[model samples]
Target: HKHLVQALRKAPQTAAVGFRQTVQKLAIVVELLLGDIPERAIFRQAPLRKALAPYFQLTQAVRLGNLQRFGEVLENFGPQFRTDHTFTLILRLRQNVIKTAIRSIGLSYSRISPKDIARKLGLDSAEDAEFIVAKAIRDGVIEATLDPEKG
Candidate 1:
């Protein structure tokens, strides 16, 4: 438990591979934590159910490999998670679809058009995608410069 706290605190310093591996590890750890909880303690108790809902939801998201939902939970119930002593762990799992998309693009293309990037990332508009691409480049997530005229 103390190790988990340490790991979460250091997550921002972790690279993409580190983030992936940590999430996998935390998923298993969460499973173990859940397995240790006595079933009778939570059974048929409304307040207990409500209190445990976020944990259950987070576990489900990790189990189901739903990073989007995991991010949503962190975004929505951050305060609740903090009170429950799981906020740092949940907060460490920052799911950025754009970042994932950028990684995929870097692997597949040397130079990609903005509209295509938008389509791959599921953005509603190419302009938005272009903005994201420029931001990503500025942030060093993507190494290539955006070609506005070409895009």
Candidate 2:
């Protein structure tokens, strides 16, 4: 189990893909390396799971497909966060989190404005929030009609 965690720490970093793909890769690693019969077995082991509880939460958040919860779990990771290649994926995942937040708002308000989404997401500017929403749409994670002039 220590070796399994070590392998996660040692995995090479690369440009991150979508959260679904990232979760799939992490699940595969846990299965292939740890003899975990089920794909999400790391989350099942109480001892090793305790040592890496935040990661377990991360997987849970990903599994639930809730970006808001993913952002909350990310806050729990705190300052001791790992710098492993896998960890870098969170930096990219954050963008998706932002997009998810936007989608949630859109669900409530069909013609929601970018500034409103930015305020809700706590982003620095409306432009950044709009950019994230656009990216999410481009990635096919969402379907939204952009209104640049209204924004």
Candidate 3:
């Protein structure tokens, strides 16, 4: 991603038209989605920040695990994401979304049932919640245990 940004920087000033800059912006979005770059890395640049406002919102949604806002952003920018070929990559952040939700749940409650977690995270089932919770624990996103008997 950095290399792509650098190459864009090296492009002749005459070629720095809207199209080329849009490509640069899309590349930056790809990097951000992959967690390969920080928001500040792009937002510090006024042009890129202004050009990529929608992507920034998407980033914010992902970070906060605001699945509703995430859906809104995707719905609003579906064409742009699809055009840039980032729709699938953005979809891959589901795990991060679930992890962020689990982290928040861990902080807010000492003990929560898999059923409650499933509902809170908008998951389809308690088993899915259990798998996500276990993954979150294994990934060090949260510290919790499952009580299958109690559940």
Best by TM-score: 3
Off by over 4 Å in 3: 8-20, 23-30, 33-37, 44-46
Model 1 error, position 24 (Å): 12
**Which portions of model 1 show Cα errors greater than 4 Å?**
1-95
Rank the candidate models, highest lDDT first.
Answer: 3, 1, 2
How many residue pairs clash in each candidate at the backbone level?
Answer: 0, 0, 0
lDDT of each: 0.59, 0.58, 0.75
Q: After superposition, how far is residue 66 of candidate 2 from its true place, in Å?
A: 7.7
Instruction: Write candidate 1's Cα lDDT for 14-104 as tens digits.
Output: 3554443444345433543443222333323443355456666665555443446766877777787675455665554433434545766
Cα lDDT for residue 33, model 2? 33
Q: Can you give the lDDT of residue 143 in candidate 3? A: 83
The candidate, 1 or 2, that scores higher on lDDT is 1
In terms of lDDT, the poorest run of 10 residues in model 2 is 29-38
lDDT of 3: 0.75
Q: State the lDDT of candidate 3 residue by residue for 1-151, as single tens digits.
A: 7777777777775756565557666675666556444456665455566667777777787778876777889899989878767788777765666667788889999999999988988778999889988888888888888888998
State residue 33's C-alpha deviation in candidate 2, in Å: 18
